[model samples]
Target chain A: MKYLNKSWIRKSSLFILSMILVSPLFAWAANAVDYSEPLENAAHQIGAIGEGYSLFSGIFPEYSLPGTNIVLDTAVAGFFGVLVTFGLAWSIGRIIKKGNE
Target chain B: MHIPDGYLDLWLCGIFYLLTLIVLSYSGYKARENLDEKKVPLIGVVAAAIFAAQMLNWPIPGGTSAHFVGGALAAILLGPYVGVLSMASVVTVQALMFGDGGILALGANIWNMALIDVFVGYLIFRLFKNKNKSIAAFLAGWIAITAASLFVGIQTGLSTIFKFQLQTTLLIMVIGHGVLGIIEGAITASAYRYLIDVRPDFFEKSNKKEVEA
Candidate 1:
């Protein structure tokens, strides 16, 4: 039993460590890059939406809040994005599982 | 690539939406039939991880940037059907909350990123797994994006809003993604290898075929 517990803890720690390593990429990207510019340039004037819409528009570079930085906005967005996505997927999976039962 | 609203005509949008609806419905049915309860949280975790990973965009030489699209990774971890649902959740969240992709083009974006990427990647991985598992994963990630890009090229090429010809869009989307897909392939391979090492039983339990490999 103790061996199993140690294995589980080790696995969980490794997973958490991987996530930590991956999380820094988001911060680096938020600080260094403008996510929208490349898409806008690729889409051209004809198709580019150019930040006129979206619930979190203010968090982006085009319509950022007065006191907020793009890095902060991106971090906030990333945090919420993970939460919402997990919730949605969990709900969908639960529904399917219940239906199957 | 997230397709913006004006990029595709309403007619194209409608068609893709219809297609997405059909595929998602079938995927749902399959998930209900095959998915285990233990796998549910795995789905959520995978979706969340993919969503967070997408924020890391590597700027390409042309005007655009590329990021890791984990459809292949999802499909490899969860089978194709559940993988579709996982990716669909991520895409939907990105559109509604972040305005990452256009509202009108949500269907097309789901079609490309969620549907084509997951299905094609799964197929490639299965086909090539017998030879080498890591190389199979690499090809899955690389070709899946390229195939998804082909559809984007078609949709944008056909749309009246975009001035680019079919050939131009095809060349741009396909070649550009083909190059960037190397990074995606490496990431997929590395991630798969790590997961296999840490939780070998997880993959075995997820799919019987994974046990064979």
Candidate 2:
């Protein structure tokens, strides 16, 4: 918990927070519809899955989480994405570093 | 922009996949040669930050939303090759976990966003850094994205399934991204300014290593 007070962590958190604040969860800005849906549908005729066949597809609606509250879902999803991204990059970096060493 | 499935034909997707593979292989080789243990955490943090920031979508006038694609910022902070890897991870995750993009079109998406965006941004930043770093950062963000958009326009326009003429798609993508790129540039410059102020040691070390190498 003490690590939370670190300057970098604090700064990073603020930046991430600012991003989430601007997201559709807050409705501060007009949410743009994905214009690709028509193209995706056209591709579907040729066996394309469009949005994707992933389990989480459409559940998050632009990568936000699913929950009773859309706002909380978006915030939680953003934070979760950050953690996952950090972990994935860190793991890859470590592997690359160790491979070189 | 995350391209969904069916946007590109399989043949084009395959070609882009091979291209992406070649670039990523070279980037991995470069990373192995140049990466430092001390910088590993920074890569993770930068990737994470980029991923988070990408979720913030800014509305464009015509009801289309544009989000910050942070490849330029990543390249500035972590060098070009490492920046590609960071962005690759972010794009890969977005496709795989979130299904934000089509699995079949993933290769093309990566080629456009991760490879083109990062390298162009890095080259632009390096080209003009001595003139004015902040402006250089801004231009890097602006031009790199526009360049990437050119490719997206080409890809979608060339595909038979897309239904838009090549000229029309090209104009729309380039012009739209060119305008949205200003916002991107401002954000990149601001973030670069903030990071440099807070983490001068990181840039100093990165620059010193670049000079020595």
Best candidate, DockQ-wise?
Answer: 2
The two-chain DockQ for each candidate, comma-separated, is: 0.37, 0.37
lDDT at B108, model 2: 93
* Candidate 1 docking class: acceptable
Candidates' C-alpha lDDT: 0.78, 0.78
- For residues B1-213, could you state the per-residue lDDT of candidate 2 as single tens digits? 678776677888899999999999988888887688888888888898888777766554544567789889888888887889999999988887678887788899999899999999988998999999999999999999999889988998888767666786677678878998998899999989987886777677665555454
Scored by lDDT, model 1 comes in at 0.78
Q: lDDT score of model 2?
A: 0.78
lDDT for B165 in candidate 2 is 67
